[model samples]
Target chain A: MAVAESPPSDPEAPPKVRVGRTPGRLGNRVFQGISTASGIFILIILAAVAIFLLVRAWPALIAAPSAFEDVGFMLGRDLWSWVWPLLFGTAISSVIALVVAVPLSIGIGLFISHYAPRRLAQGLGYLIDLLAAIPSVIFGLWGIQWLQPLVSPLFTWLSTNGATAWLEENVGPTIFTGYQAPARNILTAGLVLAIMILPIITATVREVFLQTPRLHEEASLALGATRWEMIRQAVLPFGRSGVISATMLGLGRALGETMAVLMVLSPGYLINFYLLQPGQHQSIAANIASHFPEASGLGVDALIASGLILFIMTFGVNLIARWIISRRAEFSGAN
Target chain B: MSKRIDVNDLNVYYGDFLAVEGIDMVIEARSVTALIGPSGCGKSTFLRTLNRMHEVIPKAYVTGKAVMDGQDLYGPGVDPVEVRRQVGMVFQRPNPFPTMSIADNVLAGVRLNNRRISKSDAADLVERSLTGANLWNEVKDRLNLPGSSLSGGQQQRLCIARAIAVEPQVLLMDEPCSALDPISTLAIEELISELKNDYTIVIVTHNMQQAARVSDRTGFFNIAGTGKPGHLIEMDDTTTMFSTPSEKSTEDYISGRFG
Candidate 1:
């Protein structure tokens, strides 16, 4: 079995075995080509969408201010001025969604992954997955009909209560002072988005928490650490990046969510800090859906331009998430 | 601070299945005791029962008495956490906290207990514990680096430092060097001998040579069949166990016959 021995010079000697070369099989080449083509197709589709958005939005980018008269908010204002408030609305609502969803997601994730009994964990996991599968339109209907009325009294209390008067007078005159009836405000939209993204973030966080190296957990426990202490030492740190990435994904969904915000938020075009006020905020996706039917000429292009802005923001958020995930890879202990 | 352990009629089980049955033995203080057996013989399960670490697995429980210093470890009022604080364990793999710095990892056992030490005292403890594990000289310059930055052997030593930081009375190592290279295994064996001066140590090893090299006393475990529970075949001084074991099965196993 000498691999490197020279081949015999005899005419009857058998062919020497070649160890390194793989036979060129048709099936292998076909499979490799299909997978490579599929990967490139995704990038091509992404680029094509970007190109389409830019081409469709070019007319509004250079249109005269007078051309926007049909769209009441952009009558005399340039595109940037009209879009800035929408951009603010998008950011504020999504930030609220993130701030609310992250802590709750971590709690629920840990409960399912570590705290729940074996039978209960499986049942709760399925329930959360079902929540994620519920349609956005159904959530929109539930938000407008159910959640809006339920939360109106709390907003009214904050606006008119004696205990909150000081907060309105000294701290947030614009933010907490104004309260409109029916509770169809940006804050309500944010709350609905929070509910929408809860299951998504919880699923990711729970999966990462469950995947924590059991040895690290035992190491903590062997040090006489309590259950909470063991989670603090081993579970939380390991799932930190996972939580951030999950938050970013939720942010992306919130930024582009149309039905819930459109149905829950009363439309307005203004840059203000009045979170509870009905006629003070409007998100870009909601704005486009509401105006697209009545828009004409450059008005349509203007809405698309606004969509381009939202597209860039979500893309940027995803890029940041990827960077954070890769940066933490070195010490993730998963190696 | 080292303490002896005495066990009687210990039976380990996972749910309805018994894993290790009818074990009775005494482990002397300030000495190394090695348990050698083939895979699935439940030697590691028996080791975990000493500190109640077996109960960490859902439905895995132990029945019997493991007494140390006139206290039954499995007594009704005793906390498993308190037992683990006295009896520390090292797993087969080296697992350092990935997010912690080298200095922080060395202090993990103390810090995780919610103990507050002053800055100077914390620094002194880190240096002393790392030195005790023979890792201070190699890592003193980069205390701020992550624990995973070290080589595998260094990380294992760092785990040893983390364990000893709490000043446990007994150390249980379950095949601590099975994943390591020969030189690393030698270093761990030498460290084990030095460590016996401060802590009662019980180690489960698949390698009989490792048992012969480091242990003062040895126990051989064997299983009757695939589904039957494992039991201790024989226990004696390491020299006698390797040279003139009383059980026929122990001799056959040691002589590389059927295990």
Candidate 2:
């Protein structure tokens, strides 16, 4: 059988190849290149920003403020003196926010997805989404003006009686100020942060819950499950990983929140465990926002260092979230 | 443990649109009754009403009476949940809870009802139910694995196991083998024969041969025209219905004349 070969390479004659452009292929290649370049550009910008923050923080990290002479740890001596307190404050407040936000968010999500009437469900979902659109600064103002006053009495009572008295007796007086000061405190800031992150967690969880396959829901119902029982048996188990990821997303937001914490909490340099006492704590983001404008060489670098820490924290949270999701993917049937 | 079902002048509606009208039949205790019909004939809808599952659909409602052992399922103050507990159902698709283990899937119905079962009792019930469904030998070693890890046939069997674990008096199966292969379909048919010894079984199928092979009684449903409500054309002993149906439409449907 004679094989049809490409037209014998005519070197002299006009090429039979017809190398004229094909718009579809050329456009596809151009679009592919554009997309790849954009992706790499994002990575480059992220790396550049991270490197810039590190370089700016280095000088302050090595300066060793006068207060560092009293501290003995190697890294503590080299880093800014207030770094530990700020780190502690950041972690505690964010954790407090998570503890407060997760349950409330899951409850709201379940109510909207499973219990509410169709029209009311839609309206409630939209209203919750609208909460996410509210600016952080506005939340800060609300926390300071309205929420602080509303909850001040409770804070005062808690600090004076209940667990606070027991904690003071056991842990010592130096640790807590016992609510003698104003209501602007880490507890208030954490509460505001919880409110700020609630919408995000609720929306993500609601979407996940809604995606529970109708077939599984029917299966549960056919097994004689009540509405709440069906949710527990089918919907909750199906959405477990989604809820964890959503909580992590909220935690990430809470970790980076600046304006709300800065506005609501009365900042201090000393490390204190009394979260209900005002003028006892300072979160890294809030400290940076408060001190950055007036800060000098070392102080500015210190702020940048704290910013770098915050970035690492959020990154760590996202990574852990991804790990948890991937680990549960096997049984979740979400793969 | 099985109970006879009496359905009288039943009419099912989705909002104002009647889907199935004037369905009257009796499903004898401890027998497999097969509902055979063409697509869009409301056979599945009629089957769903047996366990009050039809009303779970938005705007769906049913009229008339379906009584089991002299108790009206739709009587005033009769709880749908209680009715469903006594009348278990299997669907066309195999939907074992994807997140639950094989053993857990079997126990789901009982546990979901908040019934307290001792560990030994639960283990015994799981083995018994799985064995009864003819799936124990295949899945006994992997009871801890996710239910979704099983094949299509195995999952359907697991669903049957789940239903029987609740010890329902009647089992409603809607095309339990349509999605399965020929071999799996045969397996399910054999299992249905065994299941009917303990539970009243009502199954809806499009496969006429399946009805001929497994059912003691057969029902043929048909629609008058497009957008018209479906109604039961004829129901009789399976052998008589397949060989000498009373209605021309039943004969035409069983003889493959037209849907």
Candidate 3:
């Protein structure tokens, strides 16, 4: 065999060769550095959005110096009073959706992961993925055109039969059999939002349920526990933290949910006691989307300011969720 | 305190492929039976079949009878869950429920079966089980600690305590000491010997010395060739199996000539 090749060198000069050879390990270090750069890129995008929202909404911020002056506080009492009503409407409708959606979301998640067979579960899971992919505007159109008619009577039943007893006394309206239906009400809009956010919550929770360690299930079942008992003792305990995280994620989605709330809520300008009574019940997101096009100078700023609030609310929720899961990393990492 | 098992002409399969073939064996009451085999030999599969734990896999199954305490364990109406309850299992690596404390781990079986007891009774059961597994003295002061906090030996012993807490008639151990250090392995072997006084113990072990040290009887499993199903080669008293004559195949296996 030929001796290992080397470049021809001058015999008179001392041989000079490569120093500090990296032992072929530098390639792995380079690959790791490349991945770190991509990870940092994601962080950069998030920081940029936060900073941009802050800058754009600075003029209309609640804490802005210009937000002061009893002049505006008095005005807040008067015509410019759309803020509280909208805030109230947003809070009320989102709360309504939370009540209806959170449990249903978790139930759907568990059923898909545990109760359904492989093909049916996969098909259903794919349908949920499809729902998440649909835009909020398309959801809005579908809600108004298709869903409302189907849901209106159920709303009527809930409003009348042993339902809304609180509504009668609280709203200063006397009880009547079939008086008036706030068909385009917060109740209507909330139901729409619930349907929209269901897929999000279900996806998060299903991922969590599926991520539960297989050893845990085997260990539980080997104890001679019935399936339900195993789920309750082993699956549920391990899943509690994941459920909370999923709920937070769903809550954030609901708080910022827009077009469906806009198209269905029958926008109002008053923060009334009767949610179904249909006064000026406009959610913050709905309010902005509806009015931002019409607002002039500071009004546009004010809407951006409201957008800022929405952005912050959503951001804060996500931040708290990330913080929580870091402390208790129990949620399915894929979610 | 012991219960017998009759695994008759059992064939284990995953989906369509056979894993073990024609395993006919009877495990005596209150005695230790060791299954020794080479890699890919189906000793672990046979051990899992005893407790019906093979059902966990989607298509894994047994085609013959495994009668526990004279009840046809694979009868049409026999519940696998109930079989597992009566015949408990300890896996290769100690698997105490991570969410539970040491005491809770021991009580897990009873709790899962919804067998209620007073708090005082539960504490007594915990102490008794730990003492039974020779783990009480090491763990008595810290039963509230997470089950995973114990050293490997203590964890395996805690698992033994957990398995015995249900008062199982049979315990199926699948290479239970394979993941342990020599010291832990020794501890487990000693525990198995004492354990056999109450529970019928079937252990699948790669270590022939361990099989010799702990078992009353030994069954040697060997494969025919690559991708061929495993079958029992020989079964006899551990002493004769180790010291005296047997089939050429059995002698070859015991003598480490071939497996």
Candidate 4:
């Protein structure tokens, strides 16, 4: 049994002092701390952005002077009027991206981890890591040039024959819908986002799959199990939480992705359930990124205010993902 | 009744390192055979070679024939999967699947192989397998809990239950009771003796008395050098191996003269 030796920190615990500062045991950690200043500075900058956003958006946060019909107290425009559409689009598109990305990413991770030869697996892992490290702006530029035509043929085929009766009724009335699709739409944006985030999820999942105990696998194989069977029983169930955490990490990125969505999705102000509709349904990040450069009057406050909402949303998502990652070993438990 | 193993000039290797060399022994069906040696003498490696469990590592290979009844086990037509199905193994360390419940751990081999048995039949298999490993009464009420939740000894028994669930002809146990407490160790020893009544049991252990007490026959393997591998020194009836005759190295090992 693994007893919790300290329920919390034990009150009777002896006082301790830093080992590096001790007379005889001084080491390289102290020397390294001096050169790591830039690393420390980056954390401070992240903190500064959060604090600045908090302080600047406080007026809308406290309450609008007009006491606007803002449900979220987002500056000039009422919250429901402006924030909801962007928030909805951000959530819907990211979720759709997650739904598309997760299974395929896991499949890719599984293929590379279990199915590939050693050198090939290593090469694939490096490739995926390189893809993940590529700057977001590059993917956004690529998406604009690449994603539109990629999805056009499939969209055209589906609207033409796949949904014929529904298409016949709605095609003429909504010409820019799937029937006369302009191609740069929510799904196109989502597919692009899915591609961008695939590497991140796959890396996280692949590492987890790799960490599965060799002994458990050997035990399975010795019991007359085939390779696939060994993985299904021993590797998959053990790595399920790891895969969930990885997918959620990618979802957090997808939620806040700005340049790609803004470029690929021609931003407008209509909210429609039809995913293929060629219209403007902006994301929170894209809204802030596009509007912040030239802002005046209440629009500045509104933009900053919306940015605060987004910052909070992303923070909440990240917090949950961390919680999930931390609890993963517990869910799998110790073998 | 299905088979007996005759290992002749057997050698075990992990990459370029030959871990065990020139082992010659016969393990009788429906009886207990113990391989005992000091740490790093390659006793466990030889045990692993009996069912080809050591082949899991990339670059790990072996030479010479391990004949089971009529067929050479390492021959071209023989399948490692089928060999493993017939000759199951328990590791030096207990390894029950952490994500599965105790009942599910017992059913893992059958379930993963897509062997369909009714849920009631699965329940019966769980009980019988656990009973076979001498773990059922202790774990019966908590069969639904995760296998990792069990105490170390119970977890080891769960692994043993998992090994026997498919009902193999031979059981290869590599220090199966090494990590257990005396009570658990006693339980496993009892379980081994009972299992030998029906299955050909080959166990490897550094515990000298364990080999003397449980085995019908004992084989001694001794290592020579840093680069060179261990060789099987002698095999005889357990009574003679412990009491009077054998190789000087075997006598030195058992009498605590030298490793």
Question: Scoring model 2 with DockQ, what do you get?
Answer: 0.62
Candidate 4 local lDDT, A195-283, one digit each (tens): 99999999999999999898888988998888888888778888888887787789889988998898888775657655777665778
lDDT of each: 0.90, 0.89, 0.79, 0.83
After best superposition, candidate 1 residue A162: deviation in angstroms?
3.7
Candidate 3 per-residue lDDT, tens place, B76-145, comes to 9888888888988888877777667889999999887567899999999999999999999998898887
Candidate that beats the other on DockQ, 3 or 4, i.e. the better one: 4
- Which whole-number lDDT from 0 to 100 does residue A108 have in model 4? 90
Question: How do the residues B86-145 of candidate 2 rate in per-residue lDDT, one tens digit apiece?
Answer: 999999999998888999999999997678999999999999999999999999999998
Kindly report which residue pairs in candidate 2 clash with one another: none
Model 4: CAPRI class: medium
Put down candidate 4 lDDT per residue, B1-259, tens digits, no spaces.
3368988888888888889888888889999999987788888878888888877878889999899977888999788888898898998788988888889899988886577889999999999999998899999998988888888888888998998888888999999988888988888899888888889999998889999989999988888866779988888999999997458888999999977
- Model 1 is docked with a DockQ of 0.69
Docking class of 1: medium
Cα lDDT tens digits, model 2, A141-217, are: 99988998898887777767756677767887633346754578888899999999999999999999999999899
Best-fitting candidate, scored by lDDT: 1
lDDT of 2 at B169: 97
Candidate 3, superposed: residue stretches over 4 Å from native: A1-48, A55-58, A61-85, A163-182, A239-241, A269-275, A319-335
Total colliding residue pairs, candidate 3:
4
lDDT score, residue B44, model 1?
97
Q: Which candidate number has the best DockQ? A: 1
Clash count, one per candidate: 0, 0, 4, 1
Per-model interface RMSD values are 1.4, 1.2, 4.4, 1.7
Candidate achieving higher TM-score, 2 or 3 = 2
